[model samples]
Target: MKLRSYLYIAFTGTLIATTFSCTKLNEEFRGELEEADAGNIDPAALLINAYSSLNTPYQQEQRWVLQEISTDAAMAPTRGGDWDDNGMHRAIHLHTWNADNGYMNNTFVSLGTAIYNATNVLRFNPSNQQIAEARFIRALTMFDMLDLYGVVPIREGESLEDFRIAPEVLQPEAAIDYIVKELNEIITDLPNNGPTAAYVANKNAARTLLMKVYLNKGTFINRQSPTFAAEDMNQVITLANEITNSAKYTLSVAGKYFDNFAPDNDTKSTENIFTLFNKNGERGGNVDRTWNTVAHYNMRPGGWNGWCTLSDYYDKFAEGDERRGIYYDYAADTTSNRSKNFKRQNVGFFAGQQYNWTTNQPLMARNPSTAPLVFTREVTIRTSGATLETAGIRPVKYAFDYAVTGQRNNDWVVFRYADVLLMQAEAMLRGGTGTAAEALDLVNDIRVNRGVTLFTALTLDNLLDERARELYWEGWRRQDLIRFGKFLEAWQEKAADPDPKTLVYPIPSQQIAVNPNLVQNSGY
Candidate 1:
């Protein structure tokens, strides 16, 4: 996980050393910071740290698999790399987590830790504003757990020991209630949407997350829960309106699509409502591009191969889908242009390929990561560095900085306004209550803004396909598939993958080993 340094500076009147332990509490717990001292902690600083923590682990679990694999945006080669699980990538991306695959471990643990730490900040007597922000963060983490794992013991409290989540099967419906209640109480407390791309959980951000709570409401929280509840769907609509109505946030008019993922653009993401903070100097800052195909090329003089986009996924995009050109390029085109696109891998030289000793080859035979191909050509052919980067099917969205002294570091936007636009649309589709056309229109609005043709049709299949093209690698694909009813459909290449039992992934086997109370999902 990326380091979350949401640090709390000791304020003017923090508890005097050794004088603040409550006798009723255990002595061990008493010596640490007290509830009273929390009042002195800075809310802004605490919030920054909390946001920074979101990035670390995502580079692996989220950036690569959750978004890219699941979305039709990219895929792994069946023959060559570790990413061969792209079917499962689509499976996992498509939201079919069964008992057998081990997805929950990293998800639950990482989010749980964030909740733990964020809850710890709950110690400081926060401004009602801070209270609202802190509550939203903690609740968001649990919701993450709730979405993937299903019944998580909703842990709370300052320390891990003090945290609580029972082994009981927590239903999705119940989880939604918790999320709604928390956000409603805190939404008023969130700051007005601001211009900074870093940590800023204002009312709109809260609403956006809450809308997500509702958008995925059917499958996770309650199937009976209408996706377009005036109460629920409006949160998204209202919030999106708030941004558009108010000048607080603005979508880029020039529509430089790549800027959204560029390493340097991290802090200035106007559409990004919330993010994992990273910058040039910090250790993990700008660190994402390092693991992505965009970054490794910076360090490899031999031109480390970029993330290959899978043919299956690439096929999902219609020729009109401009994102295909923006996010991934055909290897043949790069050769024609006589250029080498500079994308990189996290585990460079000495990673997983049969390359000789060099400190910087991402594919150099690493044991843990087989380095899946983002596109197919990566496995079948090796391109000379001189070739135009358009050759292979890897992600070209994230920017690289050869100028950076070492590991190029920058924060990643976890949730953004564009996501809210899509979620609002999905809720409309499922419930048929809101403006489905408006929902669908917002997507094409993005495409139009990007100089791409607007999506003309708006069927469930069409929207899913559009989502795959527009938001493919953004990490919403898995849940998108299930909610749209495609999780059970037959796909030719997945190898007898028809069993719908694959929907809810198993809690990692390792987690069960540690806590016997944690039962495995069925069919593991």
Candidate 2:
């Protein structure tokens, strides 16, 4: 609930001096930025800045490209020279990346900066409440690091050098235990009103994190043959039950799930448990990168016309389900002059001919033979010359924000109540104490609301698909696939059976260069 950004400067001469003892202060400046007298800065702002760091890796398209593009849920085809960032996009799609990938390095840096900034906040001697929030943020980032890179650089105590100089790198299993312990310690201090105020970290947020951690513990500990231990699954059920018992959230109203991603979603939606508050024109407001990537250039706010989903994923949705919203047919409007914005509501996946707003004419594909801009189900890893502009179905999960000049006001929902319900259901389905009927009911709770038909039974495979249907583009695809053991399976554009090491991304080569303690992931 504390959203004010009171930027203040604080001097930590002791921190700076102590850190410089082992490592040169000018070498990397690992701890505090200031060495001499700097004004006392507000710890709240620092904490908020740590919160803002979520926009960098967690909320952005780069992480999405890495997670989804590497799996069957999505792909980023090399559209000629446009999206081909020196074959990096193709490399991820083809399951052939190494330690030196730029996105990999960038993700590590962003997450590391988040952890470091949170540590700086703690060094300011914040209130117990503030400290709890900072710890939650740090733990969440560390968990992400563990999930993506299999190792987390954990800096403890007041030693700022510990943040840089041979910091302890917790492997996946250790990282999970550390995160679980951190959340359990801070859960009580976190506000119980997260449902009412979705921006700030709350007890419910910590609970959700615990649920996720417990659910993925098997995979974290044993990547090759992840077995859901009974105790761990029970813990997941307990955490999920604690959240559901609170009665703070439920499925969004039918045909209005978009309200969660609407421009005013931060305050408007009750389903969001925790969110990254993104205000238009603010530093973190440009969170609509995914929306911009898929939208056409002819939009009212011109789109980048990049990033789309394969038809195989698109076809997962049942017919007439509101989740699979109507794709307007502009083929009827065939006028010549193409000067205005397109007049079509392409929400879920766009396939047919796209039209111009003013002229009502269908736009031609860039490729001569691939006119009519028809997106097909079949997509190849190499889409340089043969693939046309309409190669894949573009996704618009977050409703296009037409009001803002630069970015939408939709706060990125990091943890929502619907996700809690699904987690609880999954925990039950995996032989937890919760009933199978209850698990099926929870799945139906989300589905029936979205106009999706109620399932007679819930299986692990379809439950995974149901997760994809409900939570795609919001992140979690990679983790979900790994938990279900489907991550290494070959998909359309990616035919190579992924190596076990590919289960977790390689630690950035640049990181190993700077930190001797850090070890590169295997096969890189």
Candidate 3:
């Protein structure tokens, strides 16, 4: 797609101005950062900007909204007027979205902007490590674009003067190849997994991403009836094995499962392979939105009372699964200014009466005076009943940061070791590269850790259900559902969409309007 000249100039000016801490600039040079002076620019600053660009798309609103709300795992129902957003949430959950959808348009733009910012780093005098990091970021954004839109616009080394020229669009197959090639080439220069490297582009992270690409490449190529080629599945197994051999990661056990998403997860989580770092009152994605988005207003550390999982998805979790819900203690710190007087009531699914942790009193629903705030399992698209204010099963994936008052310290998890294990098991199951016993063993290991019973046997259906139970609301539901050939099936509030074209989202109409090379997906 063509990058508009004004937008390019504005982006460059903003990045340059922010990176250099320049408070003033002449009107004539306002949006022009001269290419001739590129030698003097700090490559590190540009790289930092590339990393920072990922915050919005991966966080609560843009990409997460598209990935989660459109699947059976989660939905943001319109509570009376709140979260209506002109039926955007309803359209996504119901699979009625068109090219004009605001969420789709914004997500497309955000991913595109992130790609541009990362690509901009390559044009500067960056070191080998910096170049690798930039390419990884660019590849990631491209992968997301490919996954969500079934196509990707690639602008290679384009200058501001060439902004009018539309970039070549890579179809699903070509996009997969391009991303695979980029990740493979950059693996050596990427950092090795470590405490400080979780937020950076690392070797294990690349391996994990490669596994995802290979595992889902079939679905990307043919979402309607995905056929996992033996070769691709083998590649997934191989890459997953590489990450396993790193000896740098392990699953967080029962009781500690929530630690992977805790405020201090950078140091506490053994499962996180790649994450976005957030520091209290500093810089990072709004990780606190993990709780605020689904929590009730009367609950301690009041939330917006939006977004929740369907009853069908919630039913997948068996009893005593630590991932379902568990009480987590965040004892108040008297000495730290960041710590609050209140604590979190629980850290997983909130299905019944909510409470104020500080007072041990049931939280009362704001809309219905004197009624307990009981989050219900039965929620409709347009809720209007006794449970209007607390409909659906609320998920608190990330533990509340009682310590941090504003921005949280929770590092948003992108890749985890548990996921790596699951992918490996799935690849083995699909490709027959390893015995069924081996695959069953791998899956049961995770189940055991999560406080669930070991399975006597394994199947694609059970594996898909296991993924849902283990990774709900972490933003892989839609992709997983599509890969399993069940995305179009009906569940909870959403109806079955027989049209295969619904598998891929429409290219934003505005994008197609600007760039003739862009075409809308089939069913839009």
Candidate 4:
């Protein structure tokens, strides 16, 4: 992802030059940030660098790291998935969903680092246009941390280390207010047409984030009244409508719905709002795994793990629904059996150096025992743990081939326009002024346009299922379930927790060790 390499390309000059800025601040606490390198790099560019930090592979919208505990999603390969076990990630995320620890803390701490960088640069000049953009980026990352783990410490000042050491002091509601209040500035200041409209922060990106912040203002924090405020809905709907009405971007052209998500093709697609930007040759993060995690066999040998999508969920689609095909992949074996592909893949050799998850052992079945193997070439697999049976399913939708790069495929689809439409519909439905009919029609448009044989009247359940079909693995399931009021309950019943103390994850221990003032979320 863009954020990983940011420490390298994004801030090398600024970080070095930042030493010179040191003289700009007073000798007191702000002194650390004031130090400067002789490079004289623009502080605004530093803030832009900070915004780019959020596009990390671990923390991107597909949530390669966070989806394991979701109700409809899970970490594939069981023991193979790190943080999926009791060591740290699993204990904090899987064992308990509500508390803050491990995965939650890592996400918090990473975002905190970005915030600290942004704030440090902003401190030099808060009124600068770049400062506003930096603040917007910080706000976006903070939303992920705050909503996932409530009442986090919100100290803002200089340097990554300075803000980090300050304290984990709990924030008042004003802290949340500060984020929302700051967006007005960002929205006004960001360009009507910014750098690479698909990836950079723009007016609409600011608005979309504003909608999210307001929608969860009450529930995420212990505010008051309904968690989703009526006023918040109005703002959200207005923003969604603005994006919808804009001729700048629209839904995927007719039947090429997947075009919105087809990775290599979206170098300049209209649907993208903000995604982890990856130039084919510049990739430093392994982002294509989201597709690899649920891809079909043609993309990789021995097929993918076929983990998330299942027949139960797949059965909801009416015959010939194009949306349904998007979720599942079917391949014919040499013998002509229809292979149900649920998981998708990114190509690579054993222990795929680029997008392949593991390549230590060649999938034995796909290759001769005496065959000499080459890197990036996928060998066949002997059906066993993780490998699917002939009649079983393989991941399909998210799969892609990256022959050029070993592990860095510029093919991961993060944000899409279809999702924008659904968000608009959900905001309308939850806002209480909209009817299910409109939502139904929105879904049917995609289905019918895609050549659905039979269209049934849509209901709330149908809409939710449609979302699962349309947005699977794009990383909205957990939030969708929470909004649906089904996360705590379904996961609780599934895990059989006598008292399900999971609504959020626990703070990471590494962070707690560093910041004592920070308190872990309840029931950790």
- Clash number for every model? 64, 7, 1, 57
State the lDDT of candidate 2 residue by residue for 1-524, as single tens digits: 22533343333332232211234552355434546333476778778777776676766555656777787777777776777888888788777888888889888777776776777778776899999999998988888888888888856664454434456778777788789899999987988774446777899999989899989888887887888887888998888878878888767887667677666666557788888776665545466676777766655345776777877888898887766664322221232221233436545666666665555667655447335656666666556554646677777766655555675666787898888888888989898887889999989988988887899999999899999999877788889998998888877777756468888899887778766778777787
Could you tell me which residue pairs clash in candidate 2? Answer: 8-41, 9-39, 9-40, 9-41, 10-40, 10-41, 335-361
Residue 443 CA error for candidate 2 (Å)? 0.7
On lDDT, the candidate that comes out on top is 3
Q: Quote model 2's TM-score.
A: 0.89
lDDT of each: 0.52, 0.73, 0.80, 0.50
TM-score of each: 0.72, 0.89, 0.92, 0.73
lDDT tens string, model 3, 1-524? Answer: 00100111224543332111113342224335553477876777777777777888787778988888999888899988799989988999999999999988888877887787787788778889889989998888888999999999866644222554566789999999999999999999998865445888789888888889999998898887788889998998888888888888887877889888877788788888888767764467778788788888876678898899888888898888889987665432222222443444377888888766656567789867688888888999998767679789998888777765887877888888888888889999897499999999999999999998999999999999999988888888889989988889998888899788889999988778766778878878
**Candidate 1 has what TM-score?**
0.72
Model 1, span 317-423: residue lDDT tens: 55544455432222212221124443222121121222222332333222223443122233322333323232345544444444456655445556666666666
Candidate number achieving the greatest TM-score relative to the actual structure: 3
Give the residue spans of candidate 3 off by over 4 A.
1-31, 159-161, 330-345
Candidate 4 lDDT tens digits, 1-524: 23223333464433322211222222233443347542464565566567555655232332345643345443332323321334443342344444334455456656665655666566554555676667777777666666555555555434333433444444536557877888886787875642234555667777778776766666566422236667777776777777766656655554455544444434434566665555556533455555454343433433343333333444555655554443322121211111222232221111221122232233332223232222221112112333331212333343343334454334344456566666666666775456677766666665555566423665546567667767665666666665665565533214434443455556665555555666766666
TM-score of 4: 0.73
Q: Sorted on lDDT, highest at the top, how do the candidates line up?
A: 3, 2, 1, 4
The segments of candidate 2 whose C-alpha lies over 4 angstroms from its true place after superposition are: 1-34, 37-39, 158-164, 326-346, 357-371, 384-386
